[model samples]
Target: MKRKRIPNKKWAAPVLGLALVLPAALPAQAATPAQAAVKSIEFVGMNAPAGAQQMAQVYTGASVKVTYGDGTVKTFPLAYKQLFKSTDSVGGTIAGVSVDANGKPIMDTSAPNNPVPYVSDAPDANSLFQVPGMSPTSLGGNPLSLVTHYEYITSNNAGDSAYGLVPASMSLTKIDQNKTTGELTPVELQKVDFSGVDGLWIPCNGSLTPWNTHLGSEEYEADARAYEADPTQTYLSSFVQNYYQDTTKKGNPYDYNYIVEVSVDQDNKASAVKHYSLGRFSHELAKVAPDGKTVYFGDDGGNTMLFMYVADKAQDLSAGTLYAAKWIQTSAANGGSANLEWISLGHATDDEIRAEIDKGLTFSDIFETSDKPADGFATIKTYPSGKTEYLKLKPGMEKAAAFLESRRYAAMLGATSEFNKMEGVTLNAKDKKAYIAMSYVEKSMEKDSKGADPVDDIHVDKISSGVTYELSLGGGQKDRSGEAIASDYVPQTMKGLLWGEDLSAPDAKGDTAADDKVANPDNLSYSEQLRTLFIGEDSGMHANNYVWAYNIDTGKLSRILSTPSGAEATGLQAVEDLNGFSYVMSNLQHPGDEMIVPDPLKTEVLNNIDANFNNRKSGVVGYVSGIPSMEQIAAAAPEESGGGQISSPADDSLIPLRDTAQAAGAKVDWHGKNKEVVVTKGTHTLRLNVGEKTALLDGKSVSLPVVTQFSKGKVMFPSGVWDQFAKL
Candidate 1:
């Protein structure tokens, strides 16, 4: 094999008093100088320009100050790009729309254009799953895909809160990425069919599973107890019945509020299943920890309790043990701090719970209620919303009650149900910390609300604008019953990380909170490589919601994105790297939704939305661009490395299977029967058949510039075949 040397571009050194070590491998050059590595990136914060906040569009004026090992500082401004909107029809159908029995599009006659996009007013939660072995350039290819869930639709332009009135939906969109410019485009969208699970209900915030599936939610679960007493008492059940559009069929309140997992194949087909074992409540989202089995949930409604579900097996949420946190408040300052202790609720499998639901068990079957504290009834408790209830568990309904009436059961078990509007839960694996977004820190979490509550664990000052809390993770913890907890990733303590301040009066832009700080932090995604935590706002306090990037290392807060006036900054997911590029996925919902926009700016905001979006009826799913890849960030850290050759260029260039695949953090396997070599990483898979001029990438056949060969106990593939996995 004759080696060819490509010209190497030298990076100037000693630019900013920083030195980075370069890893070896330089195209077989005779004497290639070490390229300067990236040392760090400092994000320079920028204020939202005056007129931009008054418009109905996503905006970002933030820039990243990158420092090279050689001390050179380069600035890359954060850019926002919308791949698609809820109102935009993709694949001949608008996302988040209801269908009649005949499959006709259900129209919102009151709104312009007539096509109904459910929760177009509240598009939330985005999960980007990269299919293994699939590439953007592959045959009929869809390597990268996005699954976005809509929370709920508004009845009118004033944004009146009406939830569980219709079956919400999540969309699976195939994404196309430009190899050269790193631009992401939505190629096609297919609404995930939830008919198997009786249709999705208020699908809210979601997270991507470690196994590359979208874990969505059915929030604002119907009150089954109330529904049993009166058929019209439950909102979600009747709507779900309407979703079925069948006269004889009745919606079961128990079926509409559980964790929904949607798995997408390489061909872009999606299938969803409801995990009943995770317990049902007003679920914001369930985030699985790095351990895979340990899951944490964000219960969105008032009087919500923090929850954790440890699955019986890794990558499976069908069966788990549910536990509620008892917040042992340590300090009341800055939105409070607490040492958490887990109180075991019970354990059950999805099948068991499903069987129970199939049996038509009502709330009366699981619990007994009383207006006062009787001998059998539990003590009276006040909800964070100021409602009072007295309940007692039935003798044989522990599992049934825990899995079905999770909120009431947790409260009955002495768990702290003080969290208000807990929105999103995300993790920083490197730091072993979990960050939870409290959209508004008030209600039962405040000191004044303890008058009627038996358990007053949280007693922090009211900060209605909200705060983000960091939970420290540790091992060797036991449940309150003294039983050793199985998972080591349990959260030990929690403290406020970042917060928003409520202003005494409205700001110049008509915002009740300071424009510079975060208001109503709702969605969160953390990037360990970037050392930054991304916070998305769902704020009525601020005229325009913004997505801010908080650097954990530098302690600098940078406003990276500003959504349209009266819109919510939701669907936040930070992808450290995908096909060698990084992205911070963000979406804006319900522009011009501000019913409280000050009189001076209300008209201007609405006018801008009419000119841009579909008169505040549309929401966008997109990402923050111009971020460096994980490979580049990893190269920034100082390290010593021995040089190694990667390619052997003969008359026909050949690439070493192990060296090349391992370099990409991929695993290589050989099949003797098929005489094939397979490389897999995450959701991607690459397969090479010996002597064939074609290779299979995530099941799609791709042409090889040269055939693969097995020679002398070693299998080597052509550079062209190898390049398919690396190149766009």
Candidate 2:
């Protein structure tokens, strides 16, 4: 593979200045009749103008219809306003404002707002009486008590150009529903801050911990060597020292990739704390089990491995014992099942590791310099506090080796490190199983190898799709000591339950046939009550990535929601409010409308672009309700003489297209060749294509889940389509 080289222009400036200055200082004696004139060559570099691409219009205040497995559909209108403009206020605090030592306004209290009365010894001591353009009166009620707070993690897809030099952050918000009108309002709290941790880099999907804190993962950190070598990156040196605590080294590779815990108090004041003991790597998500002691993490990169951290105590992840997983290959295919065993990579407290680094002992020095035995074990000695301790590294390494060089240490410890982008781990506590999503199972991970870059060494006959594996918790399996482990779930015997078929390459027609495909499963969430798993996509191969629900019992996958063009469906979480309404909180990230357009659109065409695209907003978080089953909806309805209209059977309720056309005073025609039904009412016409969810209404594409249905030899359609078509 050839790499592009950046021209070295540093010497150009000095050489050009020297040439210009020397000509004027030339001595008269040196100027001879036969002296040749100095020939000057000028090199001009031209910079092209920043090109603009066609930005897809962001859909705001729009309703999306969700079709269930039982043929029941529900529509959820945009609950929150499209978050594109930087100044568009979502939510903030009014009462907690106070002046800091620097005279800057800050939220003083971290107390969560609840029904319980709040008491302060000096309530008005350090409080600010007023703030310009902000109300003095506080909205003191606990707005988030009933509603779940969705902290959306936004990534700067456009790199430094999108959000300046700082890494993108997460936003905390809650959806409020109006009881009478059933309208939803999105209340924005404060944007999460990392404080002294500097800024996060490419924040990805995270997990809501058992203690209710958000475990945010940072992806794609800068290469340690590159950051240290570049003089312009000197500003990051202090940040690296603060996190890595290695003053002897210019930049530590151990910094900036661990899972950071973010907590939002009742007043919506957010704070962050990094848990360095969890072992740093390119983390995708960190899911805590029901016990809250064991946390499973997925590394989202090539040559990565599954990692687990068993905390010293429940709900406390600050200190833990880290381990890596080794898969016992039982099959020879991409989706093949494998029995898993955990290899202890050893552990140490954060303070102990920092102390070791202070003693000028790099994590690499302890393991890399140790002598290995023929039996595949190394004995490394360590002195934490003047007392020498020996570590019997089975597949041997240092105690702090896993925390510093996690991926490399795992591979050396006989753990499977060939997984390509292992992403999104979730637990099905009810079934005592853990589910992991592998985005596109590569051929390299299908076999065991000792070579570095196993991906290149293996042969891939066919391009494999993404797959979700279900691993059983230890129910009857015995550990190395032959002791029966009870519910001590380590990932073992993984079976492929769901496959993202759309990840396959495009066919001869340049079409992927992705209608039934759910490619690139990125974020996953499991519902205990519903026995369903929610899968979100992060792929550009599809026209619009979608959020799907896969029932564990029935094996039915439903495309519940689709995001706007050029955006990924992220942050899929299910929560129940006090009103008993189950809602799926989801985010649409980096909509396509923000991309640069190659050919500029005409003024008229550009004007049609939604105003939301006029500003730079990368993502939007919203909630989807009305997701109950048809039977549940019907059961909840009140009894009446003719029964409730919404609960009636679809066959009797749906009206024929001919009858609707006559009532609307429109002409109807059926095109057998195209398998389309055309209905024209005055100047407006709708083309309903059979077996397709999309319909063309007056030259505009509209999604109608069931555009036309056949009932009793008559072509019938949902009556709801009439109401929507009439408005158009």
Candidate 3:
């Protein structure tokens, strides 16, 4: 590993000036690099040029990421090629006057003396606002596309696993878009399938190695076909990718439950290390410490175990000790939950349980022979044909003969969670600690179940499972003088904290009523991001799709990635976009959530149409709380329980324009009579002289001043917007 100072055209001025130090190299054993989390990225006014027929301008507020690593990152030179990227100015344009859902202008894309090319046509012409795929659970966010989910690997639930795998290729061809204005610019970048990076077992999530390779987790070697066909049925290829797919097709075929060590070459050829040397069992994620030799990983599904591999040599994944977390659960109590704490059969102090697991294999047999060891636990074995088939632990202790030589690991690491164990893991080399992302799976019925009632005027239910939390690990070595729990690993940093945001208001002020169900990613979409431990979860215990972010330092959630809005994004291994936007990639279904649905053409039509015609120029749209509907009065009854009625004391902050409007002596009818409404044709102001029973445009009689209006998102008007009601 060498450090090359590639002068970056974009970061040269700001970054290079700082003269940051680069951690040149680490021992072959060191696994991952500390990615300094984003400290701040100041919004760089958008100015990229698009090469299109129409003069398009680009705009955006650019921000910088302050890596958690040593402050040595003074300057980062961005070269399209150094990072394997290509781009050009074509297709689409930045909105010269981008508006919020309320139709108020935000960014002005077209400015004089500016020089970014705008295109006439949007590349993908059919995609508009397409919703996502089938959700695994009822409490999750809207089912977005595979692209939106950004799932790097497709599990049996979302994809077909024919030949024990659902084979997919990660390659390239289009940008089709850039977040800019007017027929904007286009950048062409080729997809790279690093050499030895093909066979995908469990396409879960993981970070890139210094070697520029992907360390993917493979759950196990179960029947994925069965899982796909029916969750009720005992399918053999449970999590296999290519289980049911035709594997005869070479180069890119076959996948299973085994952590795949794959990489893409500069030439786009995918290579697979198809050896079953890495331990298996619902492998969820893999994170290599700075010491590549000492890689740490965790098992997610049925069993909640944390294991680390001490690679014998650099780059070699085989021949290592697999140790599980064994906590001194003397602190355990019966909280009357589904949480379980079982000791390892290999080292279970409980003779009964140890003997049970041992019935299948001795400590070493779990690794050596692919065959089951003559052991204890019936649960760990299955007699197939006349031979006993045991769980394949892989390369390290595959045979009982070798079990005598392999190192043993304690199974129970005192992880406290009800239902599902750990779902995400992130290691920080600079701090020498591991951040574990845990989902309660059901903290009172999850986050979005019927009872969560996310709306502002809320009738909330006791939640079953909507907890976001983490576990921290200390340096591996025990503290000097190994007297009691004497390892450097201390329990100082492990605990669950309250995560739901008490969003005072969805907006700066109260207007369109607030809803937690639509705000915080953690609460809204089960998505979060702190430093880097990204957690992908089901919205609730019952709802299955989600993404969460965990900061390794404080062990708290930070931000959240978008949901699997539709087909374009699903099963993604998230990476940051230039603007902190998450980008996911996969080779499963044709329509993923990654790209906009209906295609760019549809999006252009929809965005443009919504921006242009969907505006209400009149000071007000519609007023609520003033004239209560039958349903509103019913809703109000419950509010009394919380505190007061809808007409509770008005907080000035909540009514941003109340003072100015009050001074004008304008009343409710003034909305339609005093000002003009912006229609597709033009603004139309009404006269105040209309009498009662005036003929309505569509036969609904309005007291002349009463009218209907349209705008973006939603707006709740004040009594001052109109004069009087004239229904019926």
Candidate 4:
């Protein structure tokens, strides 16, 4: 209980409303009734960018009060991040301009579902992978074992016609060399200090602590809300230290507001610190928790609150306790389900949970306050359910008891559809599992006639897509599995994470899937040694900025990189040290809108579009291979080769794999660079640094770190990498 050390980047505004959170109040049940009655609304304002001269107007209505999930309750108006100009055409498709139950947009739908088929701009597409043993440098080089390199650096909170931003790239190659022409060009190693100012630091989704910080995340807002929503936009604010304290613009030397935490050296760059107590309202990633105590971050904006900071005094992790997973719905919970523990968030004191109206609290207490209890939380009861889900609420718990469990501690503040949108998170420290990437995106948009925004339209009925879940850390307070240290975290029973999907998608649907169909989805990176996962897709087919990979056990469709610039792979880290797992991205919206600036008010006016829009966009470590081991795919093809064996898309109900072993001889570690790989595992173990010299493994003998002792013969270790010979 050493609480009260709250001085490290204090932020006390966003609805300190009143604070009173109650869930043990019980007995009001009409099963559960108290949601649906609170309207007044009106705040619609964001538009004015196209070369701009002066536009600042954004207030976009504000009345608050939203709670749904049967408990019902509603009010209207309020969505930030606007540019709207389009008019009608509902999800039908056309020029494009819909999204207003909150994704912002009232008109402008003339043309947007056209281009969707590019597979590499093909200047050799990177050489297609030079055959023979393959080539990310003969399989043993920059393949995926990358030491460090991530790019994206421009996002202060939306709006960009290029007041700043640029410098995007992709790299990593290897995979039986299908001739991607010898890959490797990518080399930025990390750029995100953009708060240092240059490209505006739009870092996008980040957080990789273990003493080795890298927090990144800076989605946008500031420069006084991007110059009050539109005055032509300028950006630069984690507060800009109170807007740069004094010095009138230009090289103000430093101060840069907050939410940064930089560090990546060994050549990877990154450097800042900020953290501003972890509050800015647009963050997108922060995972911490390796017993490093807790960090759990998320703001995804719109109504905001899926926090958790608890480090109190333990990990020296600055301060502690700040919970907000809210959602209880218990009638003895099951399937109809609802149970995400911890509540003691903050807004400072609890004037009634910072603000008002709590008849049994369910809307995040009206805007978060979950005070007290956080330091080492321990039970309020119930949390493990279904197979382990994602999106919200924890059940299997783990990561140090979902960071010390928090039961009935107090302070719950939620408002806005059971709590406005939250997305992406994964902490499967190998089975402890925890994955979430939600987006009811304003309860699945499609709300027009003022049911009050939701029908901003992105092809309605698929509700702008983007959802992922998985939990199962296994319960805390020692119901079992707590001190196991680490093992079992499957990437689902979810707790040590938070998609906490951070900002934009009040049904924005990946911004109308870039014109009549996004289905959002960005929230990726899984590679348990390539059981796979990747994802990305913020636009349509070729899936803009392409990146598929699914199959973690059977999600199926295992490899496809593509990318050259439909750019939107925002924040995706997968490192795997020894430079093996490579993938750092953060290309904020790179080729998105292709270079930006093509609204022409609406319609596909076509000014000459082509910043490499999706059909050719790959940078930020696109491919990386060489991880085959099952005695080298049983000598390169030998029935089942080894280990588990077949399909089911992870778990659609099992089936597949009993192929009796089938065989084309299996393994093939070849890393030429892009011809993708596919070996779900067979006791897999191909570890080649191929940095040079002494690299044999099939022939026997190995050793190469420090960049790789230095390549030359003896450099063996690729007995066909893992294998999957034809006809299995």
Candidate 5:
């Protein structure tokens, strides 16, 4: 059944209430029940950036719906909070940046972790590249204190050929949480030193492992085959020269382009390790299955292959068997559907691969290649950027070829290498499903000409905006070799869930795609508790990229966020429960990027950004706020239903003490000596004497309308005192 699509419009009203569903009619009553559950939350979508004043604005408001156990429904308006910006200094250094003494970014091999600040020519990051991946974690801290550890990745230093060479850095921040309203305040930001693994390269989207570690990726890996042939090559091979600070030293391409796992200690110190067991490629991100042993990879870039790794033991990624996907297309409509079969590409241990890289094993030592057809060489066209080559594996080089030249070898063995711009992978553990974001539905994904060199398996119509495919997970499946797969989390089939709508012509805002739907969906994160998938866009087609919330059960798509014009929406991490509160992390990169913006509106967008974001030099790392806890939302219904008295926090005369005080993260204590009540949050304190219409605030006596009292063991206080706690 086709679901009705929600059109995009400029929300005229401050709050738009949307009730997803309601329960059956309840008996008429004098009051509604106190306990209510959150039925669904639908955020209002903002219009495309228009005039100069609105181009750099970020929407931070939403409407939430709550349903009580007795079937009574209500709606609430909430606002999002901004924690910090990229230009904000952390431990005296800007987030995701490194500079010299003169404050100029060092892009050469003079020092490590410092690259060209600004990148042009694409609708991507500006001076401060996006913090694409963030993992919010708690490291054995006080449960009541609400302390969270956040580690985010900076994708690259610059765009075009200068990308993937300079090593990227991951930053760790300690945040203080307010339990009452679920607000986050940053305490400190520290760079997680990656020199232990010779620094990180192009770390992109990442995920948190089941054991609580940040699993990151290194995208656009330097071509080891090309570099081995011409050691003096300046473009891609310069990654080693820049890192070692010595161009004369022999560079080893195998040392980079692997999954990097970072662990943070209780003191907030961080350590990293590169998992070479995972095959080298243009890795966007990897998602570990609920079972921990099965892992899925989203290899970014053109002509990429879908890869999976199954570890020998749970929680250990050191040794695993790698497999590539073969798409058996069942339908070519709506981004296509495929029943997948895995082809084993061999496996090895991380220690062994590291040893080979240390020994300086070149590409020629692993395989023999020829320009024309030969007796031993096989026709394989799986090189990065779509290069075809004739190659034959040498004896005893199976493990080397599998780990280093994974894509080329996979194609030689009959695996699908036609996926374009596969960006991020996320799992819906509750439903046993996984999602992969295809940033572009073009190139090899489309049907080819009759005389094309090699036939392609995936042949779907082009949708420039992109598609997010959902894969069903199941067990008892075998690989193409008929060998029993060890893990039960293998994906069986894949189909499109959220697809973008490409416009026949440019819209008024010069957007080539519909402003309402997702365009170039890149980042994905799923919340099992909410049954919603959060998507972030990396689109050049849309004037202002957006972040969306898609509810799986109801097929409802809500545009929850919109970044500044020319900026990419990224850093999407959804936390279902953090000290009883829920949060969704959505960040922006490169405001006022004018790569694809029409010439007419370029000056307006730039001027607006200059007024708001320091001349388009800032990017934000923050999360949506005001999300009520599931525990608070699941209020039980009274057995005998009645019309409940509703009280707005803004104008209520009387308020319940327990709910109000706890919601404010304030502690309430009974004082028996004076027969009074005491409330405290931070440094502020309030004391109320029973039967007296007066209160003491910070030792100053203040008049109150009503005296503090108790009703059936529940404390009740005047709503006027609410402001005293709020100010704290």
Candidate 6:
């Protein structure tokens, strides 16, 4: 691809010859407009100034003072960014330009000129990778490949609203992080193509497997009715036939809803495989135990059930025995613990399940064939005792029950199907416990006399405040391999480790009574090293949802970070760097609602709104790094140095002339006339428009290497202009 060049003559006016002259002596008062008018001009290259390599600290109101159980409180402020900003890193924006299968730019169908819109964007389920001693053939010569796996949430608005169309896919890219400055730059490498799995739907919160692969959860699967009702939708029609292998079974529920594994090689190539044996449901996250064989999954919907998939072999989820938890109430109340037993739904290989679907076996067929008694229960014969037990479904229907309608099958087989909006699940191997988040615990556990018999006595008042349960893995009879058995062993009751009611408090400003609770805990992740659980929320109860860190040992609940208004904190992953510094990677999805922007960031937030853009609501993925101790934060005070240089704490980079002009108490107008960006500091004024290399600096022409770019609706100058702005 050839790079476009800008005209230089239009920006080549002669300088005043005294542009670089600095006033040696000045009055106590500020310089007048005439004296301060810039006369000297010197164009410099793109390198940053000295000391720029050092990492700088930035703070924002989006912070929380976390009080630990040990009585230690530390305030951690969040450093955030929206879309791609040049000041963020040397590599500028790291967006993947949408391309066809043949590697050509995909032209927009709606545009008259058929312009190629860079629609393949938005980072989700971001996980960092550091593979040392990687072969040249693997990483294309880089011995160490530092990359982050980004799952594209949705392709476009149509894909989000339309259930028929499969959305955009995931991608892997090399991220260059400056060691000295702690700056990050993402470089698009390869788009992960799901050849085997066909494609994904609503790729949501995911987990980084122990074997170093990305496990992305396919959230909500389209109902079979949607596909059957509309055969004209080619995407749905193709998906039904390709995956299900039967056009007649258009509404086969088993075709979708599986955890897809994505592996990226050193060559920047990616391959995906759908783990059908893991069973299917509205999966929010699939977390593997330290053993890797036992996988725990959370169903993110109302009246769902928790699932466990025990693989035949370690680190292999391809072939597994799917089991559902049978919650046996040991205590009388809703928050009380309940003994958990895994009821075998069935076991089958991916090929075997697909073969059943190919044989014209539908979900209704399996449900109808299952044995049901008048009391509404299924019978399963015990292995050693040979005693027939009353459950909801027959044991023989594993092929259909486990793979097809897993939630219904589990419920029939005596699994607790009363969970409401069951979200992320993570296991603490060291502690031998697993944690599950229930976004609406009270609502989910509400008693219904007309509903199922198991939930008849369960009456709980609706509380939007969510809850997290910690299940104790009890001692169980071992299998031949001495592995902790699943079928026969029943776990001790689950305990409520953290309650949303306790976490809920008024906001710091005391503006509202219901301001500060962590509602709708959608994603949960456990860090073995820290013995802490990270909670990410997607809730409407609060103005902005937050990401919290709960210490299991100390029972300390800390609200670490919160999302902007109208956005959810997603893909929360806490990974320790090679230097052993713990960092969290999270995505702020669809932020920038004027109502949600804090008072401090209102101006900048409002300025970020671009009405003409497509992804105006798109948010950015940021890493919280260099967390300081409470003592350090208290000791350090704001500097009062007054210099021509101004810096942006958000990007941790030097502010451009536009921002600096405003900081210097000068008028800065944008999109005034001819969509131009005008900045006036002291007596000097600079004017430039988008897609123009010529800039009017103090009524004189100045040539730039490239046309100015817009980031988050603000005009941004190229890196080459940094040196010129430094002289101001």
TM-scores of the models, in the given order?
Answer: 0.82, 0.60, 0.39, 0.26, 0.76, 0.63
Off by over 4 Å in 6: 1-122, 135-164, 179-183, 225-253, 331-336, 358-360, 369-397, 449-461, 477-491, 502-513, 592-615, 628-728
- Candidate RMSDs in Å, in order, are 10.5, 23.3, 26.5, 26.7, 11.7, 20.6
lDDT tens digits, residue span 522-578, model 4: 555564543444444443322233333344343333222323223444434444322
Structure candidate 1, residue pairs in collision = 15-70, 15-71, 16-71, 38-636, 119-152, 132-683, 132-684, 132-685, 133-684, 133-685
lDDT of each: 0.72, 0.48, 0.26, 0.30, 0.65, 0.51
- Report the lDDT tens digits of candidate 6 across residue range 1-728: 00011111010000001001111111113453232222211111111111211101111223433322223344444454332421122133324333333333333333355443434333456666544323333223222222232333233333332222324455565655453433455554455665455455556668888777888877555443223445453345543443233457344445567888877665546677888778777777788876667787877655567677878888888887887776666653435467666667777888777776667654345543323444655543311111233444444666766786676666655577666667777777656788887766653366565653434323444445666778876456443233556532224557656555422443432112133345667677775534557777665444455666665654545555655544556667776432213356666554433233245443443343332123343445566554332212222212221223322212223235477555555555554324566654332345678777777654446767667766675667765554444345
Best by TM-score: 1
Model 2: residues with Cα > 4 Å off, grouped in runs:
1-87, 91-142, 145-165, 174-184, 196-199, 221-251, 354-397, 446-464, 475-487, 502-513, 593-612, 615-617, 629-728
Residues 543-655 of candidate 3 have per-residue lDDT tens digits of 11223333333433322222221111122243321111223221111111122223443344334322322210000000000111111212222221211112212221212
Please report how far candidate 6 places residue 31 from its true position, in Å.
Answer: 65
Q: Backbone collision count in every prediction?
A: 10, 11, 202, 195, 11, 10
TM-score-better candidate, 3 vs 4: 3
Candidates ranked, most accurate by lDDT first: 1, 5, 6, 2, 4, 3
Q: How well does candidate 2 score on lDDT at residue 332?
A: 45
Residue 170 in candidate 6, Cα distance off native in Å: 0.8
Worst 10 residues of 6 by lDDT: 9-18
Question: Model 1, residue 568: what's the lDDT?
Answer: 78
The digit string of per-residue lDDT tens for model 5 on 1-728 reads 00010011110000011222222112123132321222233444434445656656776445556554445555555555666777677556556553222333335432356634532111111111111122333532212111111222223433233344444456666665664655666667665566667666666677788776778777776777777777554244455555555567565778778888777665556677999989999778778997889999888777789998999999999999999999999987767899999999887999988988887888899889888888978776653636668889999988888998889888888899888778878998768999998877877788876646465799987777788999999889889999978888998899977677777787667777777677888888886655677788877677777777777776666677777887777667886545446677777766775445666776777777778766666767777765544433432223242212222234336677768887776656554434666665332346676777776654456676666677777767788567544542
In candidate 4 the C-alpha lDDT for residue 282 amounts to: 43
Kindly report the root-mean-square deviation of model 6 from the true structure over all alpha carbons. Answer: 20.6
| Superposition TM-score, candidate 5 onto the true structure | 0.76
What digit string (tens of lDDT, one per residue) describes model 2 on residues 1-728?
Answer: 00001011010000000000111011113333111111111111111111122223322222333322223444444333232222234554311111122222322122344221111000000000101122111332213411111222122222222211222345454434453333345455444455445445445667777666778776544433234346244234533332233445354445467787776654546677777788867777688987788788877655567788878888888777787776766664546666777777666676665554455544435443323333444322111111111223333336556776666566655676656557778998758888888765654454434443322222222224467778887546544334433336666677666664542455321224253455666778876545667777655344445666666654655555655444556666765322223456665654553221223332322343334432323345454555432222223322321111221123324578878776675656564434667775422456676667566654456655454676786777667666555432
